[model samples]
Target: MLVALDGVPVGSQDGTQLGTLIPVTHLRLPPASRMEFIVTGPSENVKSAQLITQAIVTGPNGDNDTARTLATLVAREEDDDSNVSRVPNVTGPPWTPRFAGLATAAVNTTRRLYFSENAAQTQFFITVAGQTPTVFSANNPPAVVTTQGSVEDWIIENRAQENHEFHFHQIHFLVRSQDNFAINGSQPVAAIQGQMMDMIEIPYWDGNPNHPYPSVTLRMDFRGPDVGDFVYHCHILNHEDQGMMAIIRVLPQP
Candidate 1:
């Protein structure tokens, strides 16, 4: 059988320019099966699973079914559940403490200016207001120098329209908890059940119409098998590029 892709003749094997035949000994087309040609090629660098997932071929009679299957597969990947979710404006379930904020200031100082002097310059929306990037006090950074296995509380905040994933590049830290404990305290959002990732996913919750905002908190372990300058940013690429990123220097044990 003849096969062409995008109007160009395609050879099954790049090296030998051989085409796979459905009725040939190498490939047999079952009556109801939608998959078409099965091309045999060098398997040096290909993972067995990847080969199956990315396998592709073209053939006659099953064009419509092949297209349908391919479309479903592509859609599933796009909606990968592995990806962290962004909180929606439309509420879901029951949640407390919303943390949504704009990339830039949404309000300004008035006559009272109660919480801060220049509210815009002085304060930042965070999961915890006590952290340095938010409070800017002398004790903002309590762990200037910390040892491995030393318990340091890294409070991550989510002050956006959607949830964000905070990732630690160099070292994988133990996830302590989420949105439960305070920055100054030592407990977790929940019981330390099992081991988790160095990455923390902060969920956003929309507040009431009377007062609307959303945020979540995360506790992280600073100890690591590898330590150096590492990046902390929102897994969402757009937010990181827009300044939702920071750097952390995991100091050696002293």
Candidate 2:
């Protein structure tokens, strides 16, 4: 089903404010799935309008099953719009209460880990100046080791011609910085760095030394129950099959 405001379906909701204007250009919805959106009037003076939900169902043999109107919404104007206006603004500065200590730990225990694809773009490996690149081997030693109660920062660099997604199995990480040739910057506030994600994208590098390589600074958290051996690799399946993956060991802390 599609949610349309002013006869247009918006792709996705990026903001959650009640009265904030959200642009609806174009959107596509798959069958049997539900989607939610915040619909706002195109203009303040346009008091009354229709909200239409349409469902397009397709059959397995490339034939159309049904095209039907799901629901019609009638927007009623209130005598006083003051109630909507009085709602407190919800979007603003980052919430920093729980992030202060984590930020400090990340800064103090920073660890750098570099990743890049082999020149053939078939194998994945981590690079260090003095040592040979550590290529993938199921029985090979763990490329990275950390204590179970530590937080360490990893600088993941992408040297492949195509984009690769970095993923870890047992623990999530915080994106401290996302920088490369395109946008060279950090999160607006330290609080915004609190996002805990298990995967993130590493943009492609053209193999130019002068140009900044696409990299992400991730603060990995091992303070949870995750321990023993786990794998971190390029989420791309073919890349992983071709040797772009490594094992990481998290030792139980004393």
lDDT for every model? 0.34, 0.57
RMSD, model 1, all Cα superposed?
22.8
Task: List model 1 lDDT by residue over 1-254, tens digit each.
Answer: 32322122223312233333333222212221123344454354543322223322211111122322222211232436667766576666533211111112122211110011122322322222443443323333431333443444454544332344555555433333355223212123231112233444454423223422222222344434545555555554444544444444566776
**TM-score for each prediction?**
0.37, 0.57
Number of clashes recorded per candidate: 9, 0
Clashing pairs in 2: none
